[model samples]
Target: MLPRNTVDTTVLPPGERFGMWLDLVARTSAPLRVESAHAADFAARADFTDLGAIQLVEYRYPSLDATRTRKLIRQSDPELYVLALTTSGIGTSSQDGRRSEILAGEFTFYDASRPHDVCHHANEPGRTRATSIITLIPHAALPLPPKRMAALYGGRMSGSEGLGALLAQFLIQVTGHPEQYHAVDAGRLGTVGLDLATTLLGRNLVAEDAVPTEVRRRALVTQVQAYVHRHLGDVTLAPRTVADAHHISLRTLHRLFEAENTTVAAYIRDLRLARCRRDLADPALRAQPVQVIAARWGFGDKAHFSRAFRAAYGMSPQACRDGAAVTARDVNDLASRVNSARAD
Candidate 1:
């Protein structure tokens, strides 16, 4: 789980709100700036938070002047990936040595790590309504190469098709039903985000091969692994069962695992043993018997589980559990020292 903090500044003076926004960008490392035609009445509102591996920012800009906006972007050099969807008004943006005019019903993406500028001009008074959803994710999280992503920057990618369309729709849904998402759902959303962004950006660059076969294979494997881990307690967790859940034939499923050099049963056993090892190390679980923890991770036979755990971690399950408790204490002690030092 990750901490979530929200700041809504529609109530503040435009100048004060802008200042507060600058402070937020500084703290979050999201380099962005805004200017309004009626600097006094113009409102800027943002909902920003970190969801585990991804940072999400949703913003609305109302009635802004184009020239003043140019100055703001020149100043904030935050190196991050940004996706901006315009819900209303007309604007023009330039980044990565490319410039494009943005109209209503259009969405554009750019890289903020480099310098970029966007100018918004409303058609009439109180007419501008632009909403943008920006994400700050680690470069490594994207399966595609940076050069491929750069090619797609400042260009209009199809958010109206396949996974991109679904993602765009999902974002709209989340905005409408923010309450529907819980802490756990945010992580899942982040994963979907990775897939959507990567897929769209890849389509834009014509770099379909940028995504390696193994990486795609691993992604599927990870999904299956997570599903198996979650349902390990069920007695019927087996290869055929996993295939059915994913809507793939057993032959296709076997082909997917071929690159991993392991069968589905072996993979499940390995993951179950790994989870058991982790549980055993937890001091909170120390009171529980080794057999109980083994059963929890779906090890029906205690002796077999013990042998596997020992082979994997080079220690008996009980010794590993005891060692984990000691390690947890050391970690807690170090954390306390760091906190004390910061306080000083």
Candidate 2:
């Protein structure tokens, strides 16, 4: 799991919330001049998770003015563009002389390398506080000219619809389960994020062609992979079924998989085999039988599944289930049968 930096104002005395938060944020993200409504009313908490190139910070706090100054930029390392998603709060931000009020389910992109100010206050004094998630994206991820890209900054993108909704869902997954993803997964996630953001901004700029072709292809391929992974337990998940579900032809689906150095059938089979191998190693699954595990991953024929398993893993299913060691995060088929059998 991804480690996080968490700060709760309730831990310290009410008077220390302002200073302590400043210190914590300075270490977790870009250094800034922070001002709360008043010294005594400052009550807040923040959780920050650093994902490879991106950072996800969740906050619930009273109104405050957070200023990104030139001096802070010179002092900080690896400056970024902060994309703020306000989920349950009201916020107004200003950058490059642009200002906008962000409501619930809205996002604002502000450059940490430039002078900017985010002023948020509880509309009802001590009765309310703005809550938001800040995703820090690198400048390199966005591939548009400054003037063109400036339109996305300090404005609200409806997080409730279209590509914005998809991106919001992705952000939630990354922040909610960072540990479930690996290094390569992180890079893929980051790439998809850039592609989606670029696509969103490009549409608004009336320059859809500005997005990189490879990036778009990767995004589509990632979507296909996710579909296949989610339906792995379905014995009917074939290439044709996949293509039809995606509204693409079988040939096109094969073409997409070709770029990944594998075919659609091979990909699904490999994933299932890996899962079976993992379950074979699970001591908790020791009482399970071999044939059940094979079928669980959509292997219809016991002999066929055994031969395939041995060819890929150099062992029979029974041997693997006996004492072999394997590493896998996902399992299917036989494990389901095992559970069913135990329940019966």
Candidate 3:
């Protein structure tokens, strides 16, 4: 599992919770004057993942307002690019004399060297807390020029599609599933995240030519990955089609995956099998036929899919699903017994 530091303020006293939370944020990223309605009885948690040159933090808390004043900046500055995405809330930020509204599934970029105000609100009433993820990158780590990058300060970047979406998803995945990766994978994932950010910024500024060739190539590969994911349901999603869709030669496509040490077919097949495996484990989909589930992920033949799934997972699809069902039943039974004991 990747290294992570988690701080949950709920363990502290009501009065001390907010203070501890404030101190955690200041130490992790930068100092800010944060005020929350729930501060009197605050409950919040943060998961911090250090990715060498970059840092990713996921914050879950009630609605709050925070400000990084010029005075605060003068007192302490990290000289970092803070890109925050609202995963389950509505937010607005002001910087560079501009105020940008950040709806759910959107992000805002700002510099820690300057003053900014951010307000995050729960998307609807009765929600316990709003959620967001922040990616902190050193100013020098990004390949884009400072002057051009400045144009994006306090601007909304849609996470609904394109490079912005890719970056947002990358942050969520890296922070959410650190256990799936080794510590050595952190720096590489950070680089990919930074490359996606540069691509998005450069494309928005109409300065794609300004981005380095290597970064551009990596960004193209990232885009290709996204494209393949979106088209995984299409049985015709082959290397030739993928290359043509990207307007690149088949040989170039092969070369790109070569860097990842996999062929295009293997990549696509692995993804499909993984998806199939996930669906099979889903209790709600228990009634769904194995053949139907297989076909849903571009597998037209059950025998071929079974063989591939066995090769990948070392178990037949039916056996995998059966194991999941048994596990789920055991968990539910345990919960019921615990509840009964509590009632007694």
Global lDDT of each model?
A: 0.68, 0.77, 0.89
lDDT of 3 by residue, 250-339 (tens): 999998888888999999999999999999999999999999999999999889999999999999999999999999999999999999
RMSD of each: 10.4, 7.8, 5.9
Question: lDDT value for candidate 2?
Answer: 0.77
Could you tally the backbone clashes for each prediction?
2, 7, 0
Q: Per-residue CA lDDT of candidate 1, range 152-215, in tens? A: 6676654565445555665565554667677667777777556656655665677767866664
Work out the TM-score per prediction: 0.56, 0.70, 0.77
Looking at model 3, residue 300 earns an lDDT score of 94
Total clashes in model 2, counting residue pairs 3 or more apart in sequence or in different chains:
7
Q: Whole-model lDDT, candidate 3?
A: 0.89
Task: State, as a TM-score between 0 and 1, how close model 3 is to the true structure.
Answer: 0.77
Q: Which consecutive 10 residues in model 1 have the weakest lDDT in total?
A: 64-73
Question: Candidate 1 regions off by >4 Å?
Answer: 1-4, 13-15, 25-27, 64-79, 121-128, 214-344
Q: Which ten residues in a row have the lowest lDDT in candidate 2?
A: 323-332
| Candidate 2 lDDT for residue 267 | 94
Order the numbered candidates by TM-score, best leading.
3, 2, 1
